[model samples]
Target: MISAQLPILQVLLPLLAAPLCAILRGRALPHALSVGTVLLSLLVTVGLLIRVESTGTISYAIGGWPPPIGIEYRVDQLSVIVLLIIQGVAAAVLVGGGASIVREIEATRAPLFYALFLLNLTGLTGMVLTGDLFNLFVFLEISSLSTYVLVALGTDRRALLAAYQYLVIGTVGATFYVIGVGLLYMMTGTLNMADLADRVAGVEESTTIRTAFAFMIIGIGVKLGMMPVHFWLPNAYARAPSVVSAFLAATSTKVAVYIMLRVVFEIFGVPMFLATHLSEIIIGLGILAMVVASVTAIFQDDVKRLLAYSSLAQIGYILFAFGLATEPGVTASVLHLFNHGLMKGALFLALAAVALRAGRTRRTDLDGLGQAMPLTMLGFTLAGLSLIGVPGTVGFISKWYLLEAAFDRDGFIIAAIILGSSLLAILYVWPLVERAYFRKRDPALPPVEEAPLPMLIGIWLLVGANLLFGVWPDLATGLAERSALLLLGGAR
Candidate 1:
């Protein structure tokens, strides 16, 4: 018999350990405990994924009550994929953070920093695992509040401003989400996602339900860093501590995309909404985001900001897949969600290492860096290759699927737009690669070694993962099929 307790244990192990890390009150103790807890959580997430894939959707009701009346934690292919992303990436970030965090944070406050990181991980894991919409909001806020504090811990005073800016915007997003939930509750009288899906389909004509959908989409779009609403990401990423940047890049916005997927495919049901041109609207905005953000990235001198813009453009591709509203498209979207997380996380962490060695992340700072820190720059190049959808990289797998999806629907214009966006990616990434390797600089400075071992190893693992998945695309593609089938209410 499959045990429902495992899901709760998966989330609670790290969550309950968070307070102990704070209470232990020392750098060594807390870091060790935090890493242990995250490792344990990762194991649990893997076990849960295996269980779900072998069996089917697993639902664990709180207090043994049924859903829609009592709270529930549901694990399906979609939830399992998200949980794996959160825990697996969190483990990697924590491993990498060991040295980077020590370098960046004050020794006295290291314990608190780790404690907050665990809290943020707990919140994100919870968000992915929960079946209730209201509970999703609770976890969303938990992650958001902790993230604000984490971003503010950067050495730059501008980090404080970035944190505050994110706070204002995050609060607004959360408030809109809450209002949307309230509207859904008023009409359907339930918040469980499965039950809500059934009810929402019946009431598609209800203005309140439609308004709820609109509110929730807009709220999540803001959080997901959708175009015209992504002002908070670049500064927040640029100013945050390196460890924070790595962690946020790996996990935060990915969770936001998860919430959007939940809202769109699970709750709204694509068939009901596709006729309304919701998919077309999402694709238009996505194309705009892809083109505009890539161009913006090309102009950025700050490496972090350049990457932040690149991240926005990457999100545009994922959004474009969603807009296609086909099984292949949705599958591509889900696959990219995982692929981009690994790619960007590796890229940003490499930047953190560059910052550590050179003390700056500007394009000029990276000049002649490929020779000074060959390993670090190699990692950066691999990640950049992934971003541009080079064959044998995870990025290529997603784009390939996206192209196939576009062609499936005779969407030549959309296919062209996708390819054009990739060309833009090359424009932004190539300059840095050029500056690092091909460009000449003064020959007098002492050659720097590669990033510290933990950072180097952690980044390489992700790069390796990117390539492994790229060369063998079935790992994510197969899971994406399961996720798509689940989201489409077993239509496959």
Candidate 2:
């Protein structure tokens, strides 16, 4: 009986624990609750994944009611991978990122930080699991609102402005999504995603439905930090406390991408993708994001900002894969979803350790400190290599899939562009290597040692995953393939 409730329990646990963390209102208690909640959530996801694989999609209704009337939580191939990434990142970052969080956030506010962090996780998990369109927006707000506070918890004064900027932008994005949902509700008289999917086909040809689709996509795009609308991300990531940046960068946009997949492929359906003339637009934007964001990253002096821009570029590749709307393309997008999470989690967590030792993460701050912080720098290096799509790394697995999709979709030209854009990763990534290992230390700062053991273990967990999955990618690949087929099936 309890097994049937995993779908709701996965989200409910974090949702309930968040307020308890706030109520307890102390460092140790809140931290323990946050860590315990995340670890429990991760275990729940694993169990759900096992059940979904053996039995197909699992849908649980709330209050003893059925779907289209009661709120529903759905777990399937598409959602499980992302839920795993979210909770896994949270467990790793929360358990190990404690030192960095304490260093950056005031001791007084640390309890609140843990509380907000749990709420953020709750929102992200709810967003992935909910089958109600309206509830998804609620979760989006829950997550976004929590994130705004988390970002502002940074020691820097600029964190306030960054959080404000994101808050304003994020609200606008949410409003746009709600407007779309309202239109759908009016048309179908239902807020359930499965119900809407069934009823939408009759009215999708209408102008109002088309407008709703466009609005929802743009709204989700803003949240995902899609190109041209992504000005808020770099500063937000740069100014947030180190652990917050690591968690948000690794989890937030990746989940938004999945929401896009669910919305565009499953809800709007693929016929609409091509029929509405949005496919080329999505593909073009992806191309622009890859080229433009990568170029922008090469000029960033702040290591966190550099990684932020790199993330935008990574989102482009995922979008491009999805724009193709083919089995291979969808598969590539899902694969990148899992793989990019591993590498970015590793990179950002390593940056957390870097900031702890060096005081700042500017290009200058890392100079010759590689010798001082070998394990931290080493993790950063491995993650960076994966970003560059180097062989025997998870980054390579993502690129290889993207290349395959490109080759199928447009032949040599798009494939060439994919390869060329990957070269841009090298340009941004190499500078850190040059500064960290090549230059001598400035001799002004005091001697420093490697990152804390917990931090190093967390970073290596992700880094090890990058290599293990790269070498033996069958598990991730298998799941991606199945998820993609289901996604493409709806579109077809």
- List of clashing residue pairs for candidate 1: none
Worst 10 residues of 1 by lDDT: 440-449
What is the number of residue pairs that collide in model 1?
0
* Number of the top TM-score candidate: 2
TM-score of 2: 0.98
Mind giving the per-residue lDDT tens digits that candidate 2 earns over 250-293?
A: 99999899999998888889999899888889888999999999
Q: Rate the local accuracy (lDDT) of all candidates.
A: 0.87, 0.90
In the range 1-492, model 1's lDDT, one tens digit per residue, is: 435588889878878998888787667889899989988998888888788878888889988888779999998888877777778778877887687788788988888898899999989999999999999999999899999999999988999999999999999999999999999999989999889888887788888988888899889998999997899999999899987887787788888988998888888888756866878889888888889999999999899989999889989988988888888888888888999998988898898888888878889889888988889899899999999999989988889998988898898998999899899999989989999998765567545567888888888878888899899977678888888877765521
Clash numbers, per candidate: 0, 0
Off by over 4 Å in 1: 1-3, 440-447
